[model samples]
Target: MFYHLLFPLSEHYALFNVFKYITFRSAYATVTALLISFIFGGWVIRKLEQMQIGETIDTDGPQHHQKKSGTPTMGGVLVLTAIVIPTLLWADLSNRMVLLALLGTVWMGVIGFIDDYLKVVKKRPKGMIGRFKLVGQVSYGLILGSILYFGGNGDFVAHTSVPFLKDVFINWGWFYIPLVILVVTGTSNAVNLADGLDGLAIGLSSLAFAGYAVIAYLTGHAVFADYLNLLNLPEAGELTVYCAAVVGAGIGFLWFNAHPARIFMGDTGSLALGGALGTVAILVKKEFLLVVIGGMFVAEALSVMAQVTWFKRTGGKRLFRMAPLHHHFELTGWSETQVVVRFWIIGVLLLLLGMSSIKLQ
Candidate 1:
């Protein structure tokens, strides 16, 4: 909105031209989201408190987590709100990819909100069952698959881009549908698993968004995309505004979500963020690189699956002291803060490595 109003007058006022630049607008979006998060953090937390919404830590997990029993949850809603509001205010709404990403954000957030509500308000022991969450995720995947398949506006499945290879666009044709499902489902759950600690998941998500902002900008630029041998996505530059919004929102949420967090993201934040992450990657044709950039999420999710699968395969045996990787550290005497920070460091490193792939070729 501001872009439309201000950028046109760029010729008349030198200051107005800043709105025409993706970089400048992205920075503005980031700052706007950060301010929204800080200003409204208390209100959101207060509402959660009034509603008595709290996380129900499983009895099988770390003993220390029990102390966090009554903390507010579903804080991801605030983060999403901050991001969406800023993006809408600063982004070019006519961009189809941006619209789709916004839709993905709201859709996943609604599903997650319902799950959190069931757990927090209705007091279900496990929150919405695993089957329900899986169904929601699969449904989201199908929605995206259809959009990529039949949404003529975005009708270009030329091939998936590989980061550091020459002539390496991997086309999937009909197989792309299954790949879409896998990407959506895998990313949603991976981030979900990584949300074990207060600020871990959101922090990593912030870093990933920062990297993706640059990727989107580069892919949308013909010269840069050509130089890096990346997929040239024409309308992708606007996505940087949304990515910056997320980066800002994450930082804002971290103000309250950090160690001894006042609230948790719960499924509301994690699932939605994961979906948003995957959707952006798909738009940028960087779906394959997600595994590298979001390595923390993958490691966390894998730890849980491996632990459960190995336990069932053997008699009363397990893989880690706990699952989700971070819990295992907690069980091994590392403080929750330590695990979160160390994982954050890993997230930052992975993001750099992922970024390097574009130039590594």
Candidate 2:
């Protein structure tokens, strides 16, 4: 809104010309989202409390988590609000990439909201059934993939850029749709699985978005993209504003989501954030880069899968003390804060490594 309303006045005023820069708009978007989150966070928490929406702890989990059973949850509403408002105000609404990113965020957010509602309000311990959740994810993936493949009207739409290899692209041909479906669904679940610890998932997510914000900016600039030998995606530059919003919203939510959290994001925030990241990666032709940028999420998801597979294969033997690498560390005597901080350190390192690939290629 601000972009459309104020940018046109650049012809009459020199200062308004600043609005034409993605960097300028992105910076303001970040600050706007941060302020929104800080200002409205308490009010939203109070509303959730008034509605009796609270967290449901698993009895089989770590002993310390039982105390957090009643903390107000579904705080993702605040996050989504902060992100969407800033993006709408600062981003170019006419950009197709921006519209798709917003759609992915909102669509995944609704799915997560419904699941949280079932768990907290309807008292369904399992929340939405696994199959139903998978269906929702798959459906979104199919729609997104179809749009990118058939509606993109570009040569790179059906191809993905490979990391560490300059000028290399892989054409998935007809398999692109299923690949997208897998990436979207897999990423959404990975973030969900990593949400066991306070601030862990969101903190890492913020870093990932920060890195991608740079990538988006570079990919959108023809000169930079050519110099870096990256896939030039003109429309993707607008995603920098969206990514900035995510970073700010994540940090704002972290204010209350940290250790001894005042509120939980539940599945609502996790799934939406994951979906948003995945969609952005696809838009920028950096799908493989996500594996490195979001390494912690992938590790957490892999741990759960490995644990389950081993348990089933061994017919009784356990793999880790628990599933999700964080819990395993907790069971091994690491304090909760230690696990979260160490994981954050790892996430940061991975983000740097991922960023370096952009130049290395």
Candidate 3:
């Protein structure tokens, strides 16, 4: 909004010229989101508490976590607010990339909110049937894919740039829609699985989005794109503001979400954030890098899949001390903080490795 309202006045007033720069807008967006989270974190937690929307710990999981059964959940509302308000205020609302990213975030957020509401408020142990959640995710992918594919010029190709290979792309042809659906749905669930530990998911998400903010800027700049041998996406620079908002929101939420968390993001945050990141990757044509950027999340999701597959294959034999990878370490006598910090170190390494792609190519 500020960009639309103030930037136009740049001709009349030089101060407003700063709004024309994505870097300037992105920096302020980050600060704005951080402030919003700090300002509203307590109130949102209190409101959730007042509504009696506490988390119900799983009995079969970590015995020690049982103590957190009543901690306020659904803090994603604060995260969502921080992200949306900052982007709207700082980003050019007229940008299609910004609008599409917001739609993806809000869409998955609503699905998550429904699930949390069912489990916490409606007293349904099983919140949002699996198929329904899949439907919601698939629907967003379909909409996004259709827009990007059909909305572009006749020469538009449904392809993704391969990492570490200059001018190389995997053209999915018409199958790009399915690819989008897969990326959106898979990423959202992966982040959700990583939410097992305090500050784990949010911390990793913050790092991932921080890296993406840089990537968005590079992809949008023709000079940077040419230097890096990346596809130049006009107007995609606006996504930097959105990605920065996510980073700031995650960091702000982390202040309260650190060990002995004051509130859990629940499905609401995990899904929306994951979806937003995926949407950014799609818009920037860096879908493949998501694997490296979110490597820890992928491991968390894969651990569960592997554990389940092993359990069924071996006639109930267990795989890992527990699933999601984090709990396995916890059950193996690693302290909660150890697991979180180590995972963060690994996430950081992966982030750097992913960022190296900009030059390594």
Candidate 4:
């Protein structure tokens, strides 16, 4: 909004020219989102408390979590607010990539909001039916995939850039849509599963978004993309602002969401953030690198899958003490803080490794 409103005045005012820079806009987007989250975090938490929108901890989990059963949840509303408002304010609204990313985030957020509403507000144990949630995710993925496939120009369509390999791209033809759906849905659920501990998911998410912000900027810049041997999508630069908003919102949310959390983000945050990240990665042609960048989330999702598969195969046996890798560490005598910080350390390592690919190629 600011870009559209002020950049035109650059002809008249020299300062207005600053709005033309994606870096400048992205930096301000981060600041704007941080300020929004900080200013509204307390009010939102209080409102959730007043409305009794508290969490319902599962009895099967760690005993320590039981004490958090009534903490204000669905704070993803604040996160979404922080992300969307800043993106709209700082990003080029006409950019297709930015619009698509925001659409995906808000779409998943709505689905998550419904699930949280049912589970927490209505006291429904099952929340959103599994199939319904999956349907929502799949539908959004289909929409996004179709748009990217149909609207893409020339060689960029239906192809993905391979990391750690110079100028390597795989043309998926019609299969690109399926990959998009899979990535979007899989990432959305993975982040949802990883949201078990306070500050865990958001902490890792901020790191992931920070990494992607750089990737988006580089990918969209012709000179950098050529120098780095990266796939250049000129319009993608605007996504940096959106990614920065997520990073800022994640950090701001962490202020209250750290250990001994005052609030929980619930599915609203997890699913939306995951989906948004997936969308940005796809837009920037960093789909494969997303796995490297968000390896913690991948491992967390895989642990649950492995646990379920092993339990079914062995009739009552288990793989980990608990599903989701973090809970396993928690059950192994690691404090909640220990597990969170260790995972964050691992996340940082993965981020650096992923960043190295930008140059290693």
* C-alpha lDDT of all candidate models, in order: 0.87, 0.93, 0.92, 0.94
- For 75-170, candidate 3 gives per-residue lDDT tens digits of 998899999999999999989999999999999999999999999999898899999999999999999999988999513548788888877888
lDDT of 2 by residue, 1-361 (tens): 9889999999999899999999999999999999999999999989988998999999999988999989999999999999999999999999999999999999999999999999999999999999999999999999999998899664558888888887788988888999889888999899999999999989999999999999999999999999998878899899999999999999999999999998999999999999999999888989999999999999999999999999999997889999899999999999999999999999999999999999989
Q: How many residue pairs clash in each candidate?
A: 0, 0, 0, 0
Evaluated at residue 146, the lDDT of candidate 4 is: 92
TM-score of each: 0.96, 0.99, 0.98, 0.99
Q: In model 1, which range of ten residues has the least summed lDDT?
A: 150-159
Total clashes for model 3: 0
Pairs clashing within candidate 2: none
Tens digit of per-residue lDDT, candidate 4, span 64-118: 8899999999999999999999999999999999999999999999999999999
Residue by residue across 190-263, what tens digits does model 1's lDDT show? 88888888899999999998999999999898999999887788789999999999999999999999988998
Please list all clashing residue pairs in model 1, or write none if there are none: none
The reply for model 1, stretches above 4 Å from the true place, is: 11-14, 153-158
- lDDT of candidate 3 at residue 257, scale 0 to 100: 95
Model 3 residue runs over 4 Å out of place are none
RMSD to the hidden true structure, all candidates: 1.6, 0.9, 1.0, 0.9
Candidate 4: which stretches are off by over 4 Å? none
lDDT of 1 at 138: 83
Task: Look at candidate 4 and give me any clashing residue pairs.
Answer: none
